[model samples]
Target: MHDSSHHSVDPVLAVLRQYFGFEAFRGFQREVIDHLLAGQDAIALMPTGAGKSLCYQIPALLLPGMVVVISPLIALMQDQVAALWQNGIRAAFLNSTQSSQESAKVMQLARQGAIDLLYLAPERLLMEHSLTFLSQIPIVLFAIDEAHCVSQWGHDFRPEYLGLSVLSERFPTVPRLAVTATATALTRDDIIKYLKLQQAKLFIASFDRPNIHYTVVAKNDPKQQLKRFLDAEHLHDAGIVYCLSRKRVEEIAEWLVQNGRRALPYHAGLDKETRQRNQSQFLQEEGVIIVATIAFGMGIDKPDVRFVAHLDLPKSLEGYCQEIGRAGRDGLPANAFLTYGYEDVIKLRRLLINSQLTENLARSARQQLDTMLAYCETTNCRRQMLLRHFNEAYSHACGNCDNCRAPVSTWDGSIAAQKALSCVYRTGQRFGVEHLIDVLLGKKTERIIALEHMQLSTFGIGSDLDARQWRSVFRQLIAADLLVIEPVYGGLRLTERCRPVLRGEQAIRFRQDAKAPIAVKKDVQAKRGTLSVHHHSKELWQTLKKLRQDIARQQGVPAYCIFHDATLQELIDKRPITEQDLSKIYGIGSRKLKEYGADLLRIMKQFAPDGIDV
Candidate 1:
């Protein structure tokens, strides 16, 4: 008989090898997985594409029985189930789109211990019937996707999600896992308390995606800016164009299709079928673009999206990161472009001020918005600034972003920064950016005259720079850690870091903020090191993919479940000759080698002699 210990390999590593087919775990996946496998609750704060799904999915598969996943959006649930089905996994979902009969069938399967995973909306989980149904099943784990929604202090809080604490009392024995792409320290605490997962292990992955190039441009003809961005960066790649309004989504989708691109529109305004059809087209077709609002892409499972462009200011940096995370999941290079005007700030502030939340909550939300605005206006490395907001330090600039690729020139701003800091000090650190700019520009406006600040020694020291230039200086000062904005007081203040610059002991350099250069149109050139396989070898790869697809389809699994992109690349590169050689490849264990190994070997032999000797 097989030893139980051999069967009981580290539960996390076992799932990594069996389902996801990775030989090892990535960044906190092993730790988080182990925590959940030990039947402890967990809250994982990983960035997009950081394998958040694996943390729960692995533990669910490894435990004694079924794992119930509570998701927010129906589209997200369907997409996840479809991807899992392609991988030969028995996963199903109960959402609004399902017919009652279909829901009943899925419930029956769950009762018989046949289904391994089940997905439901948070509201559905709160239903009495749903609770009754769940109580009958041997649920080993309860997973909450997008756990930030549980906190009203979070950007995407949902009331139904707040009610999810019932799961803790209803099934006290099951471990719980809460996963989100982004969360601040306060939001993290709120999630634990609200979900009643106080005992959960906390895993916070580095909030960095080095492969995504972040860029923010001034809102100069945003439509034209978007057109230029798509033309220069992602002409024939999958991407999402986010808008704040439904009308804008429709217009952008139409414009993209008219410009010889495949595009679709998605929002709550559309009927369910239309939205689903558009989403399906985007998933199945190459180079398809989806123009959408914030309502789209919550749980989307697309792996090769090449870009995510925002036509207006995002609600928060967390939202922005989550949206861009949709791209480059396949470990490929991608881009995130954002454009916003001054009016966006006014509109966002009004939205926040109109909310009925407590004053402290609104204040926190506004601060988060200010941080996002600072990011947009920054001339420094966008990646560095973003990571810094999450309390993580980035020592070097990412060489891929638009700013880093073409760095902005810097001027000696030590004197100007000192003058600004002095003005804030003289004014008792209680003035906003406009008042500060007026003092520097030496404007004889009524407000300035009323304050009688023109007579101060540092009043007119910065008269050389205009309003826009002064704005850039202040933004840079904040980014450089010299100035701090207190949202509570609605004013600017100096941090201790500014003392050295004021004393002339530290020199301050500022990026000369200027308009982005107009990209000259050029003929497309092939990327270097991207190989064009021989026609025979190309056929072999295609045959291998077809075989994998056929087996996955027959087994009701995801295509990646059979072979990941890296594994496929290895097969093309190594062309393993024997079953022994095949077994040595990553993701190809003895069982998989025996099952599909000969077919791949035969295809390789048809194209090359000896079929890559072991």
Candidate 2:
């Protein structure tokens, strides 16, 4: 029914409609593609799910030679190449997963100009032989994904990325484009500087993902809190649970499995086989949860991740944004769940202090951490705070985040602040929150008694408050910069900012820790049986998904690679029962029709009316 190739006047639009089965470009996709086509360099600073791939993908089809995509992760490359191949585009990836013979074969295909897109890791592409071989080929363009990795201050910095500038020297005529989803101003500058994109045009899209609902809860009891979150929102849904440590990842995975979930643990600590298997399972199977540390989710391109739950604080907002951006990439409704506390901050700070990073880099890391803390402590819109980190202005409160949905209540805490600061000052300014809370609550702990802190004037002054309440106070104080966590002993120290509060000239108001929010919108679907499909259409949806899974299994590719959930939903809505009908649907280009048209048509025939002709 739909012949997008020959009918369109514009060649780029025709390729997009014929191969990708889309009507038009989204966000800055069209501009970036056109710029690259004109042999101009560009930097696209878009959030995840903003159709970053299409910026390079379309150009690869229109350009003379194959586009060499220097990606960071094997999984990312595999997912992209699979999707492209399924669309009938000649795409291949050369990474660690491939043997020497396979790599040579793919490179041979490139040498003959038989491929449209070639994907590989930066390290692989930067190899001397690899570079020499590539230099001999006619490369159309160089597209670098996750470009923020070039910066030492970036959340997931890879030292190897600093070498990417060689592309400019080697491929002088080829247009180069660098794309990153998470980069603060500093990181953005670093990406530009390191990638040598000085004269490149910049495209910065809004960092807001309107489809994802953001919820951050103060960590009261993380285990139970996570259980409650999963049960209440994303139970039986495909999601990721991020922890700060590998041991915690294993524990959470085991705990989730024990509570009746198909959960897996992923971290660098796991054997390569185990990590690959778990990651493959998460991509191929529906309703699977991955519990991993920051090591797990760099270039994961899963489009239907229903939610991303963080059991611990991510080191920086850049890391936090990129991690949560994994969810809702398909543009359907999804959720982000985070549970954090002051203990996470102390732990992360200690980790940094123990590292051998330079003092300047360490200071940058601490500032990034402080910004992350501000996001958690902010009473304003969470989305606003998140975008602010990227220097993007989202002036209005996005109603999707937890704060806008259910505003938090705050109380004037000037007296509590004075007591907390005084306790820190009197108790030798070097004690951690626990011992200081002990003195304030007048707990006769052995250490407190040994230090003779009970005699201090600040002792017993905060007895009216419980330990939990006092902990919250101190946490807020640290967040407010009235106190700082000293790196050496992980103890609390008063800042000059605390002087005004101590003098009663400045009043501090701390947010009353709210309970885990019970936010359920019928419009935002996180789990199956919750998506708003009509009763009759629900059966068709399940049938379509089953067909996709079956085909994906036979092909040994991810089901989403075969057909995204959005594409299948469109199929159900259109009820295409013929090649013509199917081609008219989005994501069903001429190639996809040839590959999957008959299978889809046969499936929809089951739902056809009894009296209607087949």
Evaluated with TM-score, which candidate comes out highest?
2
Cα lDDT of model 2 by residue, 168-264, tens digit: 9988889999998976778889988888989999999989899888888888888888888787777678999999888999999999999999999
Give lDDT tens digits, candidate 1, residues 487-584: 44447779988888999999988767656644423421123111234566677767776877687668654455566545776777887777666765
Pairs of residues at least 3 apart in sequence or in different chains that clash in candidate 2: 1-580
On a 0 to 1 TM-score scale, where does candidate 2 land against the true structure?
0.94
- Give the deviation of candidate 1 from the true structure as CA RMSD: 6.2
Off by over 4 Å in 2: 1-8, 519-530, 608-614
Per-model tally of clashing residue pairs: 10, 1
User: Model 1: clashing residue pairs?
Assistant: 41-200, 85-557, 85-558, 86-557, 86-558, 86-559, 87-557, 87-558, 88-557, 88-558
